[model samples]
Target: MSPKMVPLERATAPAWRRRPAALLAIALAWPLARLSPHRLRGALEFLSRGAQPVTAAEAEDARNAILGLSVRHGGPRCLERSIAIALICRLSGGWPDWCTGVSTHPFEAHAWVEADGRAIGENPDEITHFFITMKVSVSS
Candidate 1:
């Protein structure tokens, strides 16, 4: 039998917008979410080319700005949200590492963006805990 899929829960509420670029990236990323993971990664990689790497603070600001638009954050870690964060950051002239990971114990999937070698809002200790299935880091 096929495993039943469960919808992810929202972790953030709509708050403080005014970021037009982030809103645009969120809209663009919404369609990209329909693509397969591998394809989505490629698309983001293509889009991020030529953008300089962002620092941890910069990435966190991008993340908060993306969240400001109030895209649904999944337990504060959603694939679509992370993709939007990367796109928004890139569109804003910075690039952060986008990551996809899985934990095998009970089978959990998560996605997040990182900069300066750590997931923007996650604990440093949890950084290496998951087995990263895919990642697209800056290339310039």
Candidate 2:
């Protein structure tokens, strides 16, 4: 069975029910964020191997669930937020593409998740603004 990627903020499921898992992923991702880019890429790719890809809606729901946990979860911690969401989905045998990139106009970096070729939880500007440096996709 696929991990039910319902938005904790919007779902009928009690907030407390998914809080621990989300917190765990977020906390774990915190340290992983410190890894060198090459190692971090390898780590995420290793962790997500054998997982099935989730639908864009499911991936967005997972991202939103993390966002629902805390206002602090989404904004500046884009790297960690994307990491945590991917980890959460992987733990349930669902994987989304975990990507990192940089935007040139003003020069900034960002990370995000995508599934079914759609960027989950990101605005159009974010999607086009960043040039992807790396992505962890499901193995064929």
Candidate 3:
């Protein structure tokens, strides 16, 4: 029998202002996801630290794919995948991983990207723990 397929999260559409750009990006990552693991890793390496612009579509695509696949696979590791993908998206825009953390109770892992050590989010304080494994420097 074929292995059971895990489901992925549903992605919400980006704001109307960014729909076009985001859509284009989403389409791009879909194919990239199919690349060999080594190539994907290399591409992600460049993407994570590259100073390229991250369009809304790319973020939306990545967010959707990670959420959906993790939910389908039904494992805690999904969070890491989510964080990694998110980090890559942020990195492409010249952001860097400042910290990482996990939920005390459930052991959910999350990484934060910061510019100059300051966290960016609607509520930065919500992301605590502040532990980081490795950091990829982005050139100024």
Candidate 2 local lDDT, 39-116, one digit each (tens): 998898888878899999778767766777756564577888899899878766799999999888767788989998
> On residues 47-136, what C-alpha lDDT tens digit does candidate 1 reach at each position?
888999989888877777766656365344377788888887887688998988987765777788888888877656755778998999
Please estimate how well model 2 matches the true structure, expressed as its whole-model Cα lDDT: 0.79
Model 1 vs. true fold: TM: 0.81
Model 1 misses residue 37 by how many Å?
2.0
| Stretches > 4 Å off in candidate 3 | 1-17, 26-42, 48-93, 96-100, 103-106
lDDT measured at residue 18 in model 3 versus the true structure, 0 to 100: 46
Q: What is the C-alpha lDDT of each candidate?
A: 0.76, 0.79, 0.45
For residues 12-50, write the lDDT of model 3, one tens digit per residue: 544565454334444454565466645654555565654
True-vs-predicted CA distance for residue 128, candidate 3, Å: 2.9
Runs in model 2 deviating more than 4 A are: 1-14
- Per-prediction TM-score to the true structure, in the order listed: 0.81, 0.84, 0.40
Ranking by TM-score: 2, 1, 3
Q: Report RMSD (Å) for each prediction in the order shown.
A: 4.0, 8.0, 8.1
* Maximum-TM-score candidate: 2
